[model samples]
Target: MAPSPVRPRGRGGYWLFLIPGFVLFTVVIVVPFVMNVATSFTRWSGVGTPTWIGFGNYTKLFEDERFWTSFEHNAALIVAMAVVPTVIGLVLSAALFDYIGKKFGPRTASALRAAYYLPQVLPVAVAGVVWNWMLHPSYGAVNAIFGTKVNWLGDPGLALATVMAIMVWFQLGYPVVIFMAGLQRADPALHEAAEIDGASWWRRFWHITIPQIRPEIFVVLLTCTIAALKVFGPIFVLTRGGPGNATMVPSYFSYLNFFEKANVGYGSAIATVLALIIVVVTFLFLRVQERDS
Candidate 1:
């Protein structure tokens, strides 16, 4: 007789648990992505067999001035959504956590956090529509406050910036929550030591708090970049890519081509390009994080 065979260290059934999620991912994400890439090579009317156009769609896309403008608008939005919001959230979170929480209580900090996060809880459409009306030239709250007619959404020059500002408002909450949670993980002794060394609040924040919350910073940056890149709802509801396409981003551009114009091939190419950019950016961010770590 031989010794009894050892059982596997883990449950083979664990993989079975992943099967459902794996299947759903394949159906929803994988299939659509592959099909879109394939469709990008064809000129299709969304009905019959699509004509193979090679890279004509891509060539046209690169030459389209509006496409480049949309890309530039997206880059601007990343600054508004990721850069500005992160800076503001970091300051607010540090103030609430390191100052207010120390003196008053955690409850007050929590209340402030909730207030900051309230805008994020609203449905995107509702937020868009509400802001749309609030920025109306005549009767909107913005005009009402100053008692002047300002076309917040209608003016080509100012419309994109207005949308970007609203994005900053909505994107503020995530970093606050993340940074506050990160603050909780920070060692209290570091603060005490810094204080003993006569470090100023700003000094301590720059030296200690930021280093401790680096992971949260990366997470917020990555997410906000992606969100800003693909942002659609507010642009759709408020500006409708109007005022001569000032607020148009690639996401809306793709939507217009696919649904409104029925140019499936060009739309698919735009979508694929946008997806590729997201993937490349994500990869680069992760690589930088790894190197820094």
Candidate 2:
């Protein structure tokens, strides 16, 4: 009898296909994360040898008032980023799809969606810079429009809230587009049935529209919360965390330590803390999704 052909020993071609992506992931994510975790427990200036200092960095974080200050700012921004946008987007999208589709036309609704999504298309840095100038105390359009000299980015009390407003402007478009897309996939027949049963617009929205778009709501909330947690570009350009650090956020704080202060260990620790917080938040969001599902 002829000897049986030797079988291949491994998934050679399949492993080859995975090599590039696996290498990329190891280099981009795993290595850096391992480095960050290691550095967080040591003292380093990004140039010299790192000295292991145990939980020194963790202790320092709590004692450092700036860390808490930045965290508070981040917390407030969550409301601005997630809550306001989700509510307003729902209302705006409903108005366009439900009311406008009845009276005007679908094309008009489409045009308005594009218009609302315009702010999100601009680069964050560009939008921040433009708003920085627009909120200038002297020659800014805001002062011009209101016929008053208001230092929007200067006062400690107003600086953070003003930045929140700009954030709202930047974030508004995302949810509107997402909600509108969700609305498109909803059954129009359900709305007609509800209408025939004499459901008012408010009742229908609460019962019908919301239930159908629960997944979109979670998407919007989770993404916006993450964005708020990592907010830096707008703060960097607009406020520079000014007005006595009123607008400082965790990401910018990490940046300040890593670059300006040259405290690599501290910066890494702060970043690791942020990563943990994000992980927890995502876990909670996923749990919520599971329970609801």
Candidate 3:
């Protein structure tokens, strides 16, 4: 018999591969996060010495009505980006995979999926600018088509709603793609067996499809919720948190405080708080998922 290959030395060499990534992560993420937390306890204007102010920034942030309003907008965004999209994506993915794919062809299903995912591939800035122009009160395509001068992004009452709708559209594609991919892992035989048992589509969806893709649903909701909380680009391009802060969210609020107002310390505090909330939310989501699993 051929001599057995010498046993590889203890797998210690593989650990070296992690060093580069670990270093990069520390420099890019860990260092900045630590600096940010330190900055939150001071009064800094991005330049010059930071004056230590303890929890003053946090104290002020809590009392700022704008902060509360921003969070309230974030809550609505969570609904639009996470809740609504997940529900709709579930239905759409199931239909596209089970019904359209079988009835029309795989090519047709893929084409439709690509169309839905088109928005996700577009740069956020470009999408925001296009939407802004299309929703313009004066020359917007939407208003022109409808022959109505509705200030889609300018009216405080309508601004948040408009933003929410835009978010829903922008976010729908992500869940659809994710859920469709997850559905690929689902056992086709289960669906066939259910069908053979005279199970209707709705019954099969509720009993088989949903359970099969539960993990994807959880992942989508978590990511979308975090994205909603940190949303800033669209608000910056579309309304700049204008029309009386109707579309303001924590990330935009922090941006305003940091650059526009030159209140670096306060901005750091806002960022810290937002980060904390995201951590808590993630922890809660994980715990719930663990329990269910």
Candidate 4:
């Protein structure tokens, strides 16, 4: 009889590779989040013994008009950062790839892509400073160009809109880059075949291109929506959630409570609620994607 073949080793060794990542995640994310959730239930001022006040912070938060207003602003930011950018990026990426790259050359297409992505690479602080200078009512470049003084960040009526526009500019580049990359994976033959069948650019875009890049579109929308929700850097740098809280977002509101107001429990409650919203949104997006797939 032939010797029995040696049995193969199990794949159990692969489990070892996850140890480092699991430990890091537990220490960094899990621990902190659990602590935050616990803190949200108590009245703490960042020091001393904490007073237990279960759901009090949440109750107060729901009753605050500022909290509602901040959420409203976040909804606008979602439109600016996620909705507008995805639509515009899809069109721009298709035009650049199918039209410009073919007509003018890859070099021209690349240059335009780089220009669009430039703002994304700039440091937020630097961008904010430049924008602030350019929008200053007294001696701004925009005012000089238009021959009109406009308080871009100081006026309550115009501040949120101005921030939304700025967010659109900053966010447009991200989806453009992501969608262009996704388009590279698409079958060029489909577009060519559609063209051969006398399909217009819009028709091909609607029928073929959109379906091919559906996954990328979903990814961009989900990530951008989350980014818009937690947006703090731009608010901190540009408005500090001001013109009388006109641009107050949940993240900045939480920040103000944590540091300025020294209401750690309230801040933690805000953060916890924000986290829950993000988790719910992510779950819905994943469910939709799964159903679509």
Candidate 5:
């Protein structure tokens, strides 16, 4: 009645609070993403004017056998790391959550979990160097210890698989931790009910355990898939896409085009393709999640 006593400026303040974050997002993500796409259509070598060149870069990507091979490699890696690792992590976490965590107590189990998670905390560069040393074909500690002189990173047959091994080893820890956390949050009463019904460990795991942790599995799959798609560091340091380009990934290919070949436009085109693939894969995963839910 008193002219609806002036409303507090809370909504206005909320709007004000969003401005800085919005500006940062626009500047950092939106701007760079737009520019990268724009660069895909131009003929620039990182120095001169970026002359617009229509779809020439895309044309080249399709024509180049190496580019297509890189794409295939990326697909294989995504399957191995994303699908395989997620399953492995889930299984390990489920087993640990079911038996070990209960027996060992949460604090002790957490300490052991951190032990498994050591690789993730270490610098990737250091991991690469260590792997390189361990896989040195002749004088490597791996060969010395195992009494085999297998060239892990030298042969074309083993190079990609070797890189995949490194990836799986280093990346497994994080997903295990995430899955463990998810497993911990699940209702204990569900387990008790299952046990009361005489459900075996494997049956209970297949039924109660997996369904409860589906969300965490989806998260691990998304993250692992993205990481696999962009796997460049260890390959760059350890293989350089070597052993006859057996380990050439999309990201490394893009880096080669941009820096090694001085073909920024073509590199940007490859990057655009990669971005599109990632988007498609992620969207498909989201659909799968929705259906599962």
Candidate 6:
């Protein structure tokens, strides 16, 4: 008689379950990405047959001063969003974790976490419109607080800064929640040991807290960098990349090419470049984190 055949289970079943998800992901993500790259090498006006243009679109990017400016603005946004908010969020998260999570117990901590996440639950379009009114200069809450009538969105000098400020306000909450989760997973015995040793608050944070949450730091940095790189809604709503293109970024520039200017090829080229930059930055960050770890 033939030996009984072995049946697949556990890992085999998991792999089988993942097939549908993998197929859907490839269809939605990989196909579009390849199509975008193909579009980048062709001169296409959405409705017409695409003509091969070699590197013309890419060469044109180097000569376009507005494109460079937009790229520079995006770099600035990446730095601000990655560094500034991480610092602020880390400090606030540490404080909340200490005060609410540790001292006041789980119930209060859950309530506080819910409050911080409220802004993230709101739609970006609504947030953009609300921020536009809040920073409207003459009639805005910001000006009213400072008691000075200054053009926030209308002035070229202030437009970029206003957009940055709005981004910081909205983006901070999600990171705070991330940090809190990291804090919850940290070993409590480490804190107890530090307390017994009479370590100062700063000493404890620098030595114990940060090293334990290194994974979270990497996550927050990468997420914030990607989000900032593609910022558009607030710029569109508040300034329309305006007051003479002072508030423009790569995402808005690409949108203009595709929608307003009707140059699909140029837009795809910009998008491809943006995608390359994101991939490179994320790769570098992961390598650095691995080295440090």
- Highest-TM-score candidate: 2
For model 5, the stretches where C-alpha displacement exceeds 4 angstroms are: 1-10, 13-24, 104-108
- Candidate 5 lDDT by residue in tens digits, 39-78: 9999999997999999999998899988988978888887
* Candidate 4 wrongly placed segments (more than 4 Å): 1-23
Q: Can you list the residue pairs that collide in candidate 4?
A: none
| lDDT (Cα, 0-100) at 199 in candidate 3 | 100
Model 1 spans > 4 angstroms off: 1-19
User: Would you estimate the TM-scores of all the predictions?
Assistant: 0.93, 0.94, 0.92, 0.93, 0.90, 0.86
The global C-alpha lDDT for each of the candidates, from Candidate 1 onward, is: 0.93, 0.94, 0.93, 0.94, 0.87, 0.85
Residue 5 in model 4: lDDT: 61
Model 6 lDDT, residue 182, Cα: 96
Clashes of 1: 0
Ranking by TM-score: 2, 1, 4, 3, 5, 6
Error of 1 at 145 (Å): 1.4
Give the number of colliding residue pairs in candidate 5. 0
Worst 10 residues of 1 by lDDT: 4-13
TM-score of 2: 0.94
Note each model's CA RMSD in angstroms.
2.9, 3.9, 2.5, 2.9, 3.0, 3.7
If both were scored by lDDT, which would come out higher, candidate 3 or candidate 6? 3
Q: How do the residues 1-293 of candidate 1 rate in per-residue lDDT, one tens digit apiece?
A: 89866667666857988999999999999999899999999999899999999999999999999999999999999999999999999999999998999899999999999999999898877889889889988789999998879898899999999998888888899899999999999998999999999999999999999999998999899989998888888888988888899999999999999999999999999999999999999999999899989
Worst 10 residues of 2 by lDDT: 5-14
